[model samples]
Target: MPEHPWDQAGPRFRPPPGVTLYVPVVVAFLVQVPPTIGVGLWLRAEPRWLLLATALAAASALALLAARAFPGLTVAVVAAIVTADLFLPPEVGPPPIALAFAIVGAIVRGALIWALGSVGAAWLVVVVVGGVNGHPWHPLRIAAATLALALCFAIGAGIRRRVERAASHRAQLVERRRANDQAERARIARELHDVLAHSLSQIAVQSGVGLHLFDREPERAREALASIRRLSATGLDEVRGVLAILRGDDADSTTPTGISLTPQAQLAEIPALVAERTGHGLTVTLDDGLRGRMPRSGIQTAAYRIVQEALTNVVRHSEAAHAVVHLSCEDDVLVIAVDDDGVGSAGRPEGGGVRGMRERAALLGGTVDLTVGPLGGTRVLARLPWEEPA
Candidate 1:
C-alpha cells in the first residue's frame, strides 16, 4: 500500500516506549510535590488549604502520563488543575511545569488547534476569575506567561520540522537505490543476452555443418566439431566472468572455475570476432580506421556489444553471404557501420536483439539505426560519443 507523507514522518518523532516515556512524568511529580509541600509548611497555612495545594500539584503532574497518547485531553485537564492551584494562598502551590510539558506534547503530536484552544480558554478563565475575586492584575506576570507558552510552541514546531526533513531524506535515498538496482539488472540482462545468443547461434550452425559433412567429408566434420567446442568454451568463460562480477569479485582475476574473469569484449577484439565468423562460412571483413586509438572502457564495451548483436542478427536473419564491419572516429564520435549483401530486412519485426542493441548504444549517449545499405542489404549504424585519451 502507498504510504502517506505523515505516516513516513511519524516514526521519526514517535513517542518513546516503556519507562523512557514516563521519565518526564516522574520528574514533574517530584518537582511539583516537594516544592508545594515545603512552601505550604513554611508559610504555616491551614491544614485544609495545604492539603488541597499538594493534591492539585499531584493531579497536574499525573495528567502528563497520558499526554503522549491523549495529548489534547491531557493538556486541557492539566490546564484546569494548574489554574485551580493558582487561586491558593501565595507560594502554597508549585510552578505550572507539568502544564508546559503537556502543551508542548500536544503541539508536537499535531494537536495544534486543541492545544491553542485549551490554553486560551484557561488563560481567559484565570484573568476573569482572578479579577472578580479581588486579586490584583499584573501585566508583567501575564507577559511572562505568554512568552513562555510561545517558546514551548516554537520548540515543538522546530523539532517537528527537523524530523520531517530527516524522513524526506531517507525516502529519497531509498528511491535512488531502487533505480540503481533496476538499471544494473537491465545491464546484466543485456550482457547475458548478447553472450548467450551469439554463442548458441554459432554452436547451432556448427552442429548442422558437422552433421551434414559427417559422411561426405570426415575431415571437414572434425573441423566443425572443433569450432563448436571452442565456441562453447569461450561462451562459458564469458558467462563465468559475468557471474564473478555480480558476486562482487574482481573481473580481472581468475575464479574458482579455472576461468580468467576478463572484462567484456572491446574494440580490439572486433577483428577476432570477424575472423571467427569468416571461419564459420560467412565472408566477413573488418575496416579499422581508428588504428590503435581506443575510446574509454565503457564506450568500447557498448560499441562491441552493438557490433556483436548486429552480426548475430545478420547471421540469424539476414541470410547474407558477405558482410563488412566498418569502425571509425569522426569529430569525437565513434561510428560503427555493418553492411551486408543478402536478403534485406524488409518486414522483419523488431525483436529483443534489436532492442538490446538500441539500449546499449543509448546507455553511452549514442544511437543505433537500421536502413537499406549501399550493398543492397540491411545496414546497422551506431554512433557513440568518444573521449579521446590524454
Candidate 2:
C-alpha cells in the first residue's frame, strides 16, 4: 500500500519543493523572452514595451515562491500580469506558465475558489480588450480556455480526495495498535496476578507462622518452611511460563501453544485453597451454590482469581481470623463474595489486587464492589456474566 505523503500533517498547507519554485522561475523567464521579441517585431513596438513585459513576467514567476504562504496574493499577482499583458501598448502574450503555477499552488494550499475567480476575472478582461484591439471573437479559443480551467480544478480535487483517504487510514491504524496494546497489557496482568497473588500470600503467612513456632514447635516450624519452599517453586514455574510466552519461545514439550506450562487454578480448586488457608490458622470456608458449573475456562479462571485475591486481602490486610467465600448464580450472573471478620473497612485504602478484580469483572461486562461486611470487615463482591462474550 502506498502511504500518503501528508499523513503526518493532515489537510494543511505544505511548502512547495525547492525545485518547484526555482524551476518555474527559469522556465517562465526563458519562455517570456521569445513572445516579447515576436510581439515587438510584429507590431514595431518600442523597447520600453518589451522591458515592461519582461518585468511583469519575472514578477509573476517570483510570486509562485510565496504561493503556499499567500495563495490568494499569488493568484492576484498573476491575474494583474495577465490583464497588463492584454491591455498594454504592445500585444505581449500573458505569462501562461506563471498563471498555471499560481493556480496549482492555490489548489494544493486550499484556495481553489479564489484562484479560479481571479482567473475568470482576468480572462474576462482579456476578452474585452482583445476585441477592442481588432481581435475577432473566436469560439474555439473561448472553449479551450474554459476546458483548461475545468481540468485544473478536476485534478486538484482528485489529489485532495486521495490525501483525505490516506489520512483516515493512518488514523485507523493508530487506533487499532492502541487497542491491541491495551489488550496485551490486560492479559499479562491477569496472568501475573493469578500466578503470584496466592503464592505470595501463602508465603507471607507461613513465614510469620514459622518465626512464631521456631522454638515452641520445631516440627510445625519445619512444615511452614516446607510449605514456603513449595509455593516458591510453583510461583517460579508460573513466572518462567509467562516469560517463555513473552519471549516467543517454541512450544513447550507438553503444551502446543507454550502459553501455560503450569496448570491454571480453576473453581474446582477452591476447597484445596481453603485447606491451605486453614493450615495458616485462618478459618476459610467455601459455599458454592451456583447452578452453572464451569461455563468456560475464562469465567472459571476469573472466579478463582477473584476469590484468591479476596482471601489474600483477608490474610494480608484484614486482621480477621475467619473468612467466608460464597459463590452463587443469580439469573445470568455468577456472583463471588468474600467476607471476613477482620479489622478491614470499606473506607480503607486499596491496592493493585482490588484494581485487578475490578478490571477482570469489567472485561466480562460485570462488576466488583468493595463494601462493609456483616462481620464488621471489608467484603469483596464480584459479579460476572455466566456466558462469556463471543
Candidate 3:
C-alpha cells in the first residue's frame, strides 16, 4: 500500500473488535447507569421492582455485547426490557435511550430485528399510556416507530455519501501521480540522449580512426589522435551538463558545449555519427526507408542509447572494423538495428546494463533483440511503439 504522509497510523481505523459494531449496545447499557442508582430510592417500598429492573438491564447489556456470537439475541433482550418496564409500576427511567439503541441496531442489521424490536417496545408504550378508548390501540406507539425508521435512513444515506466522496478523491490523486511520474522520466530521457549519445559516438569514431596511424599516412593519423583528444574533452563537458540538470541546476551554463547534434536524429543519423569513420577511411551506409518520424524526442532517445551501447560493445569485444545501423518503422513498431563489421564481438550477451536497456524499451512498449549479423558484425535491435502527442 502506498503510504500517505497523513496516515500516522494505518488506513483501517478499526476499533477494538466489539466496541465499534456494538457501540449502540454499549451506549444502551450505559444509559441504565443513572436509573439503576436513582430507582433504588423509589423502589424501597417494593424491592422486587428494583431487583427485576436491575437484573434485566444487566442481562440486556450482556446480550448486546454477545451480539457478534449470537446475532438477533439482543432484539429479544430489548423486548424483555420493555416488558419489565410495562409490567412493573412505571417510574423515573433511562428506558428512552434503550429504545434509541434498538432502532439503530435494526437499521444496521435487517428488517426482522426492526419489526420485532419496535413491536416489543410499542407494546409497552401502548399499555402504559392507556389506548384510544381504554382498549389496545395507541397513536404514540406508531409515531415512535416512524421516527426511528427515518433516523436510520438519514444516517445510512450520510455514511454512503462520505464513502463515495473519499473514493473519488483517492482515484484523482492516483491519476495525477501517474502523469507526474511520466513527465519526469521523459525529461531525464532527453538529457541522457543529448549527453551520452554524442559523447559515446565521438569516442567510438576517433578511437577507431587513430588506430590506422601505423599504415595510411602517419601524419594524418596524428590528426585523428588529436581529434580523439578533443572528443574526450567534449564528452566530459556533456556528461557534466547532464549531471547538472539532474541536480536541479539547469541553465544556459548547464548546456553541453560540443558538436551539438539535431534533436530528432535516430538510427537514421548513423551517417553523421559515422562521419569521422568515413573520413578516416571506413565505409558507412544506412537504410531507413520508414517515413513518418517517430516523435522527435523518442526517436532521439532510442537512437542515442542504441548506438552508444553498440559502439561500447564493439570497442570491447571486436577485432574487425566498420558499423551500420538500420532504423525504420512498420506502422506503430519502431525498428532499430545496429551492426558492426567487428568479427568477434557477440555483444554484451548478459548483464544488468542490457537488462536496464530492455526495461527502458519495454516501458516504451517495445523490446531489444541482440544477435550476430550475417556480415560478421554484432547486431543490436529494438522496437518501440510510435505514440503521438495528445
Candidate 4:
C-alpha cells in the first residue's frame, strides 16, 4: 500500500484571470480623459507641461489600482461617458474603446452574461441621457450602437470558451500524472514483496533441511548447512535492494541481513535460488539458457515467487519425496510452474501464502493458476510482464 512520493505534490496555479483588466480603466478614469483623449492624446493634453501633468499621472494611477475590484463598475462609468457624447459635442477627452475587452475578459468564459451587463449599462445611461437632454431619440442610431455592443459580447464568449478548454486540459493532465504515479508505486510494492516473500520462504526451507541433516547424517547436514548460509546471504541482498527502492535516497550498500548488497537481481538469481532449495533435500532443476533472455526485475521476482511459494507448500505439507520447479520466458511472459509429489492435497490452498502468490502476479498485470497436476502433484503457475524499454 505504499504510495508514490509525487502524490504529495499539489496543484499548480492557473493564469491570473482578466488579462487586460487594469490598463484602460485606471488610466482613463484617473486623468478624467476620454479613452481617446486621456490615453491616446496624453502628450497633446500636456502641451505646455502645466501642473495638470502631475494631476493627470496621479489620477490615472489611482484609477488603474482601484479598477481591480470594480471592472464592472468601471465599465459602467465609461458607458455613461459614451452616452453623454450623444447630447454634447464629442469632447477631446480620452475615448473609452478598449474597456470592451476588459469587461468581457473578467466574465471568465461567460461572455454572454458579460455582454448583457455591458449592453444594459450602456443602454440605460444613453437612453436616460437622451430623455433628460430634451432630445428626440432616433432608433436607427441606438440600434447601431447596440449592434456594436453585441459584437463585443460575442468576442468575449469565444475567449471564455478557449480559457475553459485550456483549463480542462490542464486538469486532465494533472489527474493522469497522479494515476500513473500510483500504478508505479504498486508495481514497486509487488516487486519488494515477491523478493522478500520468496527469499524468506526459501531460507526457511533451507534451515529446516539443514536441521534435519544435522540430526540424521552429519555429512549431508554439512552440505545443507552451506546451502542455508548462501540462502541467508542472498536474502539479505534482496532485502537491501528493496530498502533502496523504497528509501530512494538514503539507502546504501548493506541490507537488513548484515550482508553487502547489489543494485538489483536479475534472472541469474534464479539458478542460485533453485540450487539452494535443492540442497534442502528437494530436487530443483533450473534452465540456464533462459537466464539472459529474462531482463525485468519485476518479472524475475514474480517467477521466483511462484517457484518459491510452490516449493514452500511442498516442504510444509507434501511430505513428498521430490519437487521440480520450471521457469522460462514464453510469449513475452515470465512463466513459472512448481510441482511437488507431496502427500497432502496439492491443489488446495489453506493459507495466506497462496493468496500472496496470486497477488504478486496480479500486480504485474499478470495471472496465477493453482491446481492439481496430472501427476497428482500440486502445481503453481504465474505469468508476469517483462519490461523491454531500450
Candidate 5:
C-alpha cells in the first residue's frame, strides 16, 4: 500500500477502481474527431450525409464515456453506427474509430457474450440492407471486420490475464515473508530457553549451598561463593553473546574482545557439561563414538543443546544421583541418549524443557523418544541426521 507519485501530482488524475491510473477515453474521443472530418471531406458528400457523419462521430465519443459504466451498451451503440455507415457508400470506411476501443472494453469487462451478439446482429443488418439497396454483399470486408473484432478481444484478454498473474505472485511473496518471520521467532525462543534455563538453575543451586554453609564451614562456603561468581560471569557472557547475535553482530569470533570468550556450545562441550553436573552431586559418565570431526554446525549445536536440557531437567526435577550420557554414530546418523536414575512415572508430566528439546531435534531433522531408562529412571534419547539435506 505504498503511495505512488502520480497520485500526489494532481487532482484531475483520479481514475475509477480496477482501472489504470490514466484513462484512454479522452484519447479515443480525439482519435474519433479527425476520422469523421476526413470521411466527409474525402467523399464531398451532401449536407445531409455530412450531418449524419457528424452524428456518428458524436455517438463514438459517447461510447467512450458509456464504456466506463456499461461496456455492453457501448458495444451495441458502436455496432449500430457501423451498420448504418455500411448503407451509405462502399468507401465510407467501416465504423467510427471508437468501435475498436468499445470492443476491447466489452471483452475485458466480462461482456464478451453481449459484444459478440451485437457484432453478429450488425453483420446480418449489413447483408440484408446491401441486398435490398442493389449493393452486393462483400465477403472480404466482412472477414476483415471479424478479424479486427477478434484481435481486440485477444489483446484485452491478454492484459487481464497478466494483471491476474501479477496479483497472485504478490500474494505468494507476502505469505512466504510471514512464514519466515514465524520461524525466526521460534528459533530465537529456543536459543533463549536453552541458554538461560541451565545457567540459572546452576546459579540457584550454588547460591543455596553457599548460604547454608556460610557459618558452619567457612572454607566450603568460600568455594561455593567462588562457583557462584564463576557461574554468574559465564551466564552474563553467554547472554551477551545472544544479545550481540540479535543485534546482527558476530559473537562467534574466537578472538577476544575485552572478554574471556569460548566458542558456541557444540558436541565437544558435552564432557565439560557432564563434569560440571558431577561436582553438584550428580554422578555422570560419558561415552563417545564419533571422535575426530563433527558434522554441520547446526546439527552439533542441536545435539549439544539436547544433552544440556536433559541434564538440566534431571538437576531441577529428578531425584537421581547417577546419570549416563552416550554419543555415537550409527547408520550415518549422530545419536545422543541421556539416562538418569530419577523418578519416571506418569505423576511427573513433561514440561516445556522436554518440548524445547524435541523442537530443536526436529529442526535438525531428528527425533526424541522419552521412556523409562534401563536403570528404572527417565531416559531421553535423540537421533540427528549427520549430513544435512540440501
Candidate 6:
C-alpha cells in the first residue's frame, strides 16, 4: 500500500523536554503564592486557613506538571482546586493562575471541550455560591475574568492552528521530494536500459558474425571485432556520463579515460548513429528535411532518443535488408518516422523498449505511433511539439 503523507513527515508533534516541562509549573506556583501569603497576613487569618490556602495553591500548580500529557484531566483537577480556594476568605484567595495555564494547555492539545466545560462550570458555581452567601462578585470583575479566559482560549487556538499549518507544509515538502526521487529513478532506469540493451544487442550480433566468418573470411571477422570494440567504448562512455550526472557532477566533465561525458545525443548525431548501424550489416538511410531549422534542446534530445530506440528495435527484431529514417518539421511539430522492410511486427509486444519510446515522447508533450509502413514492415512515427528557431 502507498504511504500516508504524515508518515513521510514523521511522528506527530511532541512537547519539548527539560526547561519547558518545569518552567510553567514553577511560574504558576510563584504567581499563586504571593497573593495567598500577603492577603492572608493582611486579613490576619487563622494559622489553619493560611496553611490550607498555601497547600491549595501548591496542589493547583503541581497539577500542571501533567497538563501536557493529560490536558483535559489537568484542567478539571485545577478548576476544582480553584473553586475550593474561592470558598476561603475573599481577600486571602490567590488568583487562578494555574487554572489559566491548564485551560491554555488543554485547548492547545486538542481538549477543547474539557477545558471549556470545566472552567465554565467552576465559574458558575463560584457566582451562584457567592450570591447565596451575600458576597456576590462585582459585574466588572466577572466580565474581566470571562474575557481573560476567552483570551487564553484564543491564544491556545491560534497556536494550534499555526502548528498544524507548519506540519502540513512539512508534509508537502516531503511528498514533493519523494515524487522527484521516483521520477529520477525511472529516468535512470530508462537511460540504463537504452544504453545497455542497444550495446549488448550490437555486441551479440557482432560476436555471432565474427564466429560465423572466422574460418571462411578472417578479414570480415576482424572487422566485426573492431565494430564490437567501438560499440563497447561508446556504450561505456554513455554509461559513465549517466553515472556522473547521477552523482551531481557536471555533464560536460570528462571521465578518467579522457572520454567527455556527453549528457545527451543530439539530432546531428543521428546520422553517425545510422552509419554505425549500416556498418554492422544493417543498411540504414537518413532523410533530413529540417535543413537549418533546429528545434529546442529538449525536443532535440527526446527526438534523438526516440529515433535511436526505434532504430535499435529495428536492428534487434526486424529481419529487413534496408531501413529508412525520415525527419521533418510540419506545422511547428518535429516529425520523426523510421520505416523498415522487416517482418511487419508479426509477434512484437509492447515491451520496455516501446514503453521507453512513448515515455520519451510524452515528456516533450509528444506522441509516438507504431503502425504498418508502406515498406511492408513496422513504422515508428513520433511527433513532438516544437518552436522554430528565431
Query: What lDDT score belongs to each candidate, Candidate 1 first?
Result: 0.84, 0.77, 0.60, 0.60, 0.77, 0.85
- By TM-score, how accurate is candidate 1? 0.78
Error of 3 at 280 (Å): 12
Residue runs of model 3 more than 4 Å from their true location after superposition? 1-32, 35-48, 51-236, 243-253, 256-269, 275-297, 317-322, 328-334, 341-367, 376-378, 384-389
On the 0 to 100 scale, the lDDT of residue 355 in model 1 is 85
Query: Top model by lDDT, which number?
Result: 6
Clashing pairs in 3: none
CA shift of 334, model 5, Å: 1.3
Please provide, for model 3 over 156-195, each residue's C-alpha lDDT reduced to its tens digit, 9 standing for 90 to 100.
Answer: 4455466567778667767766766665666566456545
Candidate 2 clashing pairs, residues 3+ apart or interchain = 320-342
Candidate 2: how many backbone clashes? 1
Tens-digit lDDT track for model 6 on 46-153?
888888888899899999999878999999999999989878864546578898889888988899999989999999998999999898988998898889989988
The candidate that wins on TM-score is: 6
Per-residue lDDT value at 75 in model 1 = 88
TM-score of each: 0.78, 0.76, 0.51, 0.55, 0.74, 0.83
The ten-residue window of minimal lDDT in model 3 covers: 255-264
Candidates 3 and 5: which is better by TM-score? 5
How much does each candidate deviate from the true structure in C-alpha RMSD?
5.7, 5.4, 8.4, 8.3, 6.1, 4.9
Candidate 4 lDDT: 0.60
Candidate 1's displacement at residue 262, Å, is 1.9
